[model samples]
Target chain A: GAGVSQSPRYKVAKRGQDVALRCDPISGHVSLFWYQQALGQGPEFLTYFQNEAQLDKSGLPSDRFFAERPEGSVSTLKIQRTQQEDSAVYLCASSLVPVGRDGYTFGSGTRLTVV
Target chain B: SQQGEEDPQALSIQEGENATMNCSYKTSINNLQWYRQNSGRGLVHLILIRSNEREKHSGRLRVTLDTSKKSSSLLITASRAADTASYFCATVPGDAGNMLTFGGGTRLMVKP
Candidate 1:
C-alpha cells in the first residue's frame, strides 16, 4: 500500500448497534493512531499503538470504544452501542519512528452515521 | 477538552487574498504541526515547527511559533480557491511518541 487505508468508507448503524472499523497502515510503520472527527471539529485522538502494544487509550471517550492492533500491522476500532453522538469520521494514521518522529500519513477515514 | 483552539472559527476571503489563522494551546508541547482538511475528509500534514524554532516556511505557507505563549499562526499567501479548507494545529506533548492532540481548526472559504 502506498498510504494508510481505511475500510468501509461509510457506515450507517442503528443507535445501539455495534460497529467495527478497520485500518491498514503502510508496511512496517511502527506507530498507529485512531482519531474521531465530528462534523465541525478537528480530529480528536482516540488511541495509539506502537507495534502490538496499546500504550495509550486515555483519549477513548468511554467504555464503548475499543481499538486493537493485533499483528502490529492491521488495526480495528470497535464501538459498542453506538449513539447519535458517535456519528463522525474515524481517521487512521501511521508513522515510522523508533521514537516516533515528526511525520505522519493519514488514511481517507471512515464516515460513520448512527441512525 | 479541546487543548488547542484556533481563533476565527470560520473565515471567508477572496481568491487572491491571503489568509491567516491562529492557534493557541494550553500545555507544554514538544512540537506543533499544522494540517489542512477538505470537507470531512482526512487531514493533510502541512508543516511542523519544533518548540525551539520560532518560524518556518514552505512555499507560500509560513508558520510561526510562540511556545512562550503556547500559540502558533499559519499564513498562506496568494491563496487560491483550492487552498480554502479547514486548517488545524496539532501538538505532540513533551516528546511523546506519535500521539497528537489537535485543535478545533479554522474553516476558510475562498470565493472567486
Candidate 2:
C-alpha cells in the first residue's frame, strides 16, 4: 500500500461492548505504534512494536486494552468493556526504520464512540 | 502525561499572514517534531529539530529549538487557508528510544 491503512473508520459500541481496530502498515515497516487521541487533545502513545515483538506497552491505560502484531505486518487493538471515557480516535502509525531518525506515517484512524 | 505544552491553545489569522506557535517541555529531549492534524483525523509530520540544532526550515515552515530553555517554536510564513489545522509538538525523551510524547496542540484557523 502507499500508506498505512486502518479498518473500521468509525465504530459505535455499547458501554460494555468489545471492539477491535485493525491496522495495515506500509509493507516492510519495522516499527509500528498505536495511539489514542481524545477530543481536542493530542495523540497519546498506547503501545509500540518492533517486528513481532511488543517492546513497550507501558502507555496502555488499563488491563482491558490489548494490542498485538502477530505477523508483524498487521496489527489489532482490542478494547474490552468499552467505557464512555474510552471513546476517542485510535491512530496507527508506522516508521520505515527506528522512529528517532524518521518521522512516522499515520493512518486515518478509527473514531470509536462508546455510549 | 504530555511532555510538551503548546501556548495560545488557539489562533485565528488571515491568509497571507504568518502564524507562530510555541511549545515548552518539562524534560530534556533528543528531538522535537511538529505535526498537523485536519478534522481530527491522522497527523502529518511537518518538521523536526534536533537538540543541538537551533533552527530548521522546510518550504514555508521554520522551526526553532532551544534545548537550554526546553522550548521550540514553529513559524509558518505566508500562511494559507489550507494551513488551518491543529498543530502539535511531540518530543522524544532523551533516554527513551523511539517513543514520542505529544502536547495538547495549537488549533490554527487561517481565515480566507
Candidate 3:
C-alpha cells in the first residue's frame, strides 16, 4: 500500500459490546504502534510491536484490551466489554525503523463510539 | 501519560502571517517530532529534530529544539488557509524504545 490503512472508519458499539479495529501498515514497516485519542486531546500510546513481537503493552488500559500483529504486517486491536470512556479514536501508526530516526506514518483511525 | 505540553491551546492568524507553536517536555528525549492533523483525519509528520541538533527546517516549516530547557517550537512561514490544522509535538525517550508520547496539541486556524 502507499500508506497506512485502517478499517471501519467509524464504529458504534453498545456498552459491554466488543469491537475490533484493524491496521494495515505500509509495506516493510518494521514497527507498529496503537494509540487512543479522546476528543480535543492528543493521541495516547496504547501498545507497540516490533515485527511479531509485542515488546510493549504497558500502555494498554486494561487486561480486556488486546493487540496482535501475527505476521508483522497487519495488526488488530480488540477491546472487550467496551465502556463509555472507550469512546474515542483509535489510531495506528508504522515506522520504517524504530521511530527514533524516522517519524511514523499514521492511519486515519477508527472512531469508536460506546453508547 | 503525556510527556509534552503545547502552549496556547488555540491560535488564529491570517493567511500570509507567520504562526508559531511552542512545546515543552519533561525528561530526556532522543528526538522531538511535529505533526499536523486536519479535523477528523490522521496526523502527518512534519519534521523531526534530534537532541543533538538545535534546529531544522523543511519547506515552510522550521523546528527548533532546546534539550537544555526541554522545549521545542514550530514556526510556519507565510501560512495559508489550507495550513489550518491542529499541530502536535511528540517525543521518543532517550532510552531505546519506539513509543512516542504526544502533547495536547495547538489548534491553528488560518483565515483567508
DockQ in order: 0.63, 0.72, 0.84
Error of model 1, residue A97, in angstroms: 1.7
Instruction: Give me the displacement of residue A65 in model 2, in angstroms.
Output: 0.6
Tens-digit lDDT string for candidate 2 (B4-82): 9999899999999999999999998889999999995799999988888999999999999999889999999999999
Worst 10 residues of 2 chain A by lDDT: A96-105
Off by over 4 Å in 1: A98-100, B95-98
Window of ten residues with lowest summed lDDT in model 1 chain A: A95-104
TM-score against truth, every candidate = 0.96, 0.98, 0.99
Best by TM-score: 3
Candidate 3 lDDT tens digits, A66-98 = 999999999999999999999999999999997
The lDDT ranking, best first, is 3, 2, 1
Cα RMSDs, all models: 1.3, 0.8, 0.7
Q: Rank order by DockQ, top first?
A: 3, 2, 1
Query: For residue B69, what is the lDDT in candidate 2?
Result: 89
| Model 3 spans > 4 angstroms off | none
What TM-score applies to chain A of candidate 2?
A: 0.98
Per-residue lDDT of A46-99 in model 2, one digit per residue for the tens?
A: 999999999999999999999999999999999999999999999999999875
